[model samples]
Target: MLLFSRNLDKLFFRTLEKQLALTYATSTEPQREEEFRVLNLKHVKGQVAPRRPLKKIVPPPPRTQQMAENQDWGNVWPGPRSFHPATVPLPVRQGYVEKGVSPGKFGNAELMKIPNFLHLTPPVIKRQCEALKKFCTPWPKSLDSEEKCERHFPVEVSSSDYCHSSPTIRDPLARIVSVKVKLEALKLDARARDKFLRLVGDRYDEESDTVTIVADRCPLKKQNYDYAMYLITAVYHESWNVEPWEELKSEADMEYYIWENNASKVNVEKIFGKEAKDIPQIEVYSSAVDKYMNEGESDHTVEQYGQAVRKILNLPSLGA
Candidate 1:
């Protein structure tokens, strides 16, 4: 019985092994075929990639050759920029070379590095002016002549302008302002004139009778110009003023010698008595003395003074 059981167990185990082997072979055979197909597709794709064609380089045409003679210059150069020989449409050349010639417009480093004003050609300027003419007003009919203009506008303001390729646009000298006006424009009397001269010091020109005021303390040109105008106005108003103490000033404090306040006037008054005003020649004598004292004692002035004194005293002349 044990030998029969052993033989049956062996047969059952052998059948189960055969069944498992067949199942595994059937499942794995399709999986292996799918993986092999996927790998073949990947290999075919790697081998069949389209090749990119190499680009062929082509240079641009020279702008000078393309430019027309009747082309608008304004369009060519609308603003300031580094020089470009090709765009300029001119036979421009730069750089040093041997006896042959300078470098042509093909490659000019010097020309490209420098600034150019090709945009401000005469035609372009004319076109710009024509375009801007509508915004500008015509000159006034009343101020036709320079004299009339000066009469109406006595004060002249002066300033400067500068242009450069700097980091800052401002110029130090541009902030300085000069204001000038004729002394006659103020219509000042002798007292005011004297005061004005004293106040302005060396700024007053005796020959031209012009007052010049310069202002540069302010940072901006407009501020300096306004300050200069303010100074002029202040000087004019201050010069016209009279203080209470001015009336108390004695003859010694006077700017020029006055015949009316001199001791000669008192002596003449004593000699002529209360009728000094009645004497016609007394005025002439006073004028002679004033001229001698104020205008320096010249030979002519001294002779005039002597003649006046002799006439006033009723003395006989040596010539007579």
Candidate 2:
């Protein structure tokens, strides 16, 4: 009787489950139970399907193995894609192993994870360039040489674009913008040039004749570029500007010596009288003094100044 009751209960649940098509996993929503027999069965197991024979899975031979010896790799790897050992003919291996050689490419997770540029082979690159040539504009015939390019595009604004894996979307270096222009390109006079040099300090490359300003204070690349340009403009205009106190600057207060304004010129004029400016030796003395003062005292400059002074005074060389 007990066995019969259990069987009847089981049959009732099976019938109810089939009718409702509900499982304990699917009873996410609240459902009120009716009295006694209609109560929610906490352990309502579903009917299992009959077991069947399993079929085996077999992989085909590698594509590389079947490919001809002289097959075109360009066709095989048409574009960039994930690495497949079966497709690649090379015996690529990766992973660290102590005793044995590195694991073959067959199941190399490292190989699959890293980027591959098989599609960007020389032949493929040449083909791509040839195809793209039609879309590109021809080079300007006017700006043929590098010097001409520099003259035309004086402001060489440089910035970088990055494509890398990091926590942040934008790279710190990408935000930095460097503005480069030739010092001569600004067309600054002596006073303005001195002021500009003082303003830029080490940022000015004397060897290259370029003034470089790096702007990274702003967060965005465009803002930094704008800031760099603003700096260049400001320095240029400020150098040209003369303050009220500039007139008060005496020979002693000057940053660099002017050959025309110095006491040396007045002394030479006193010695030669009215004909000081007319003398050919006076010009040589002026050049030597100008170079010595502006370029700083050196052996070559000292020798030049000494020779010029002797020439001006009509002094004869003494035998050693």
Candidate 3:
């Protein structure tokens, strides 16, 4: 009889569960239905016919090997690289999020690469001490040694003295240092004169027969020609970093030749006419100059260069 009662109870509960599950699956407001079941189902209804409960049916437990073979892990993986955001898994989606790894992020870790030497004038030794205290790490080599490690930074002592001279005024202050007759001056024809003037200039007044030219000089000795050339190369590198030699050299080489001839007088009679000998001379400030001159005939700009180039190209000026 006890066994019979237990079976009957089990069947009743199973039927109730099935009915509840069906109602829940269909009901949009299932929470309300749960409340109703708890509150309004206390009283039994009249004319209670003998209710035959449906037989409880459960499928067989899945085979472990079959499940293992058939299991889908698409959910674990982030969907295709092109997958919609809504379908991607949490871990996979968050993996692409990049948090900044900057200097402040690493607390107490030496984050900055300190310079080996102080660069500013009136060096800050105190700041250096503080930085060393906070970030210095023990390395295999001693600081005094010249040997540098893969990560080794070395400090060197250098001394500099600052000397102030007169405020530079480009009042044409060029002094003649030395004057020598150019050996090649005899070969300076109309073309050579034009080339020389391009480097210097044709600040010559035909009426006055005064001629002027400009040249740059350095105190460097003859032995330092290579070093001086390097300095000139540095100047060229900075000025015409992108310009082609084809555009600049035809003129620059001539100018360089004039510089190589330093302190030499060249005849420009055929180029500047017989009056060229009377043109005012404008010598550029160089260690070779005797004195710096502020006054000359006339300085030429690119626009004024037409007359000068005509002299070189042997072409009649448009003005003429």
Per lDDT, the best of the predicted structures is 2
lDDT of each: 0.86, 0.87, 0.38
Compute the lDDT of residue 284 as modeled in candidate 3: 26
Q: Is candidate 1 or candidate 3 better by TM-score?
A: 1
Q: What is the Å distance of residue 65 in model 1 from its true position? A: 2.0
150-244, model 2: which lDDT tens digit per residue?
99888898889875445566988899998899998899998999999999999999899999999999999999999888888998899999999
TM-score of each: 0.63, 0.68, 0.13
Q: Residue 21 lDDT in model 2?
A: 65
Of the candidates shown, which would achieve the greatest TM-score relative to the real structure? Answer: 2
- Tens digits of per-residue lDDT, candidate 3, 167-211, equal 442222232122212213223454444443343333433453323
lDDT of 2 at 14: 92
Give the lowest summed-lDDT range of ten residues in model 3.
285-294
lDDT of 3 at 212: 29
lDDT of candidate 1 over 1-52, digit per residue (tens): 9999999999999999999999998988845444343445646655866789
Model 3 quality (TM-score):
0.13
> Which pairs clash inside model 2?
none
Q: What is the lDDT of residue 74 in candidate 1?
A: 86
Q: After superposition, how far is residue 159 of candidate 1 from its true place, in Å?
A: 1.3
lDDT of 2: 0.87
